[model samples]
Every structure is written in C-alpha cells, then in structure tokens.
Target: AQSVAQPEDQVNVAEGNPLTVKCTYSVSGNPYLFWYVQYPNRGLQFLLKYITGDNLVKGSYGFEAEFNKSQTSFHLKKPSALVSDSALYFCAVSQRGTNAGKSTFGDGTTLTVKP
Candidate 1:
C-alpha cells in the first residue's frame, strides 16, 4: 500500500535557525510527492513537490526538499525558520495509477517557531 508517515507531530524551533520536518513514504512504482502548509482553519497551500528530475526541489516560502529514492524519503528543509512560518505541514503522495489525482496525506506536523 502507498502511505506517508511524518514521524514528528510537532517541532519547536527558534526563529532564524534551520528547520526540518521529516517524511518517509512507501508505495509501488514512482510516486508524486508534495508538501503543503495549512494555517488555522484555512486550506492547504502547496509548498513543494518531487515529481522527477533533480533530487533537491525548491518551492515557495524559502523551503526545499530532497528526494531520496534509495531510502524512500522526502524530507522538507529550510535554511532559516520564521515565527510566521509556524503552521501545520502535511506531506502528500499521489499515485500513478487510475487514482493519480487523488492524494493521500500524512497526519500532519505542527511547526512552532519561537521568536
């Protein structure tokens, strides 16, 4: 079965420090990976995605992720954290079969940045 696991429920970090939210996935064949952020009660905003090509993919909000095919991991990273960056982060995967458009999301990881 294809699934994503975000090990950390929440991560607390000081503003300006580098931050990372881990994600690992299991699936058959290649997967379309995505990262989204949701603010209080709002819909998720797309952050980044690893479809194909380079291992490091950059996206909005100064965030980037490395796609590790061997370990089957796609971990989100940022060089510097911000207080405003604190929100719920979700890792999603879309399959290549008939359910391509459908995305399965991880439980979510709440990032708390202290100023």
Candidate 2:
C-alpha cells in the first residue's frame, strides 16, 4: 500500500520569509510524488511533481520540492512567503505502475502567512 504523512497541521510564516511544509511517504516500489495547493472553496491545483530524474523539482507559484529516496521524503519549499500563498497544501504518492489518478494524499497542511 502507498501512503503519505504530513506531520504538521499548520505552518505559520511571515511575509518575505522562507516557508516549508514537510511530507513523508511509503510505497511498494518507486514512487510518484506530487504537491498540490487548495484555496478556499476551490479545487486542488497542481504545484509540482517528481516522476523521475532531478531530485529538486520546481512548480507553480515559485514553489519547489526536494525528493529524497533514501529518506522517502518530499518537502515543499518556497524562498519567500506571501499572504496570497497561504492555503492548504497536500503531499501525495503513488506507485510507479499504479493508477496515477488513485494517488494517496496526506491529511493536508494549512499554511498561514502573516503580514
């Protein structure tokens, strides 16, 4: 079985500061990792993904993540935080040969950026 864990319930950051949302995962084989963001009353939007190659993957809205195979972790990072960037973040994973549409998502972490 494949699953993801987000240890933090909420992350608070000041505007212009760096922000990070942690995530860890387990899968039967090589994993397909992804990050998504959701705004109030909106659908989930794709942020970035790590399919293969390049441990460091960049995504929408100036966000990026590092894929660590040994640690089985994929942590989302942003160089500078913005109030607009505050939203619900999710980490998900699926096995290489499984249905991509069926990826397991974490509980989700809410990011709050203060002015």
Candidate 3:
C-alpha cells in the first residue's frame, strides 16, 4: 500500500519570498510521487513528479520538489512566491508495479501567498 501525508494544513507566504510545502510518503516498493495544484472550482493540475531519476525535479509555474529517499519526503518549493500561486496543493503517492493506477493523496495544504 502507498500513503501520503501533508503535515501542514496551510502555508502562508509573501510575494517574492521563498515558500515550501511539506510532504511525506510511504510505499511497499519503489514509489511514484506527484504534486498537484487545485484552483478554486477547478480540477487538479499536475505540477511535478518524482518517479526514478535525480533527487531534485523541476515542475510547472516555477515550482520544484526534491525527493528524499532517506527521509521519505517530497516537499514542494518555489524560489519566489506570487499571489496568483495561492491554491490548494496535494501530494500523492503510488507504489510502482501496482495494477491499479490509483494514488493515495494527502489531506491537502492550502497555500496563501500575500501580495
């Protein structure tokens, strides 16, 4: 089984400041980690993923995430935040080789970027 956790329910940041949203996961085997953003009344949008490559992976809208095997973490980061970046972020994980493509997701973290 695979699971994901976002310790923080909300993250507040100022525009032009760096921001990070924490996430942790557990899986039986190799894992596929993903980050998604959901705007108001819209479906989730893919941001980044960490399948099997470098520890650090970049993603859309100037966002990035680093996969830490030792810590079992995949925290999302942005160098400079923007007010428009405010949204609900989710962390998802799925065990590799799983028959179903279903992914376990975190409760979600609401990001509020103040201008």
- List lDDT for all candidates, in order: 0.93, 0.97, 0.95
TM-score of each: 0.96, 0.98, 0.97
Answer with 1 or 2, whichever has the higher TM-score.
2
In TM-score terms, candidate 2 sits at 0.98
Give the alpha carbon lDDT tens digit for every residue of 1-115 in model 1: 7899999999999999999999999888998999999999899999999999999999998999999999989999999999999999999987777375578899999999999
lDDT of 2 at 48: 99
Say what the RMSD of model 2 is: 0.6
Off by over 4 Å in 1: none
Listing every candidate in turn, what is its Cα RMSD in Å to the true structure after a full C-alpha superposition?
Answer: 1.0, 0.6, 0.9
Candidate 1, overall lDDT? 0.93
Lowest lDDT sum, 10 consecutive residues, model 3, at 94-103
Residues 1-115, candidate 2: write the lDDT tens digits: 7889999999999999999999999998889999999999999999999999999999999999999999999999999999999999999999988787889999999999999
lDDT winner among the candidates?
2
Most accurate candidate by TM-score? 2
Positional deviation of 91 in candidate 2, in angstroms?
Answer: 0.7
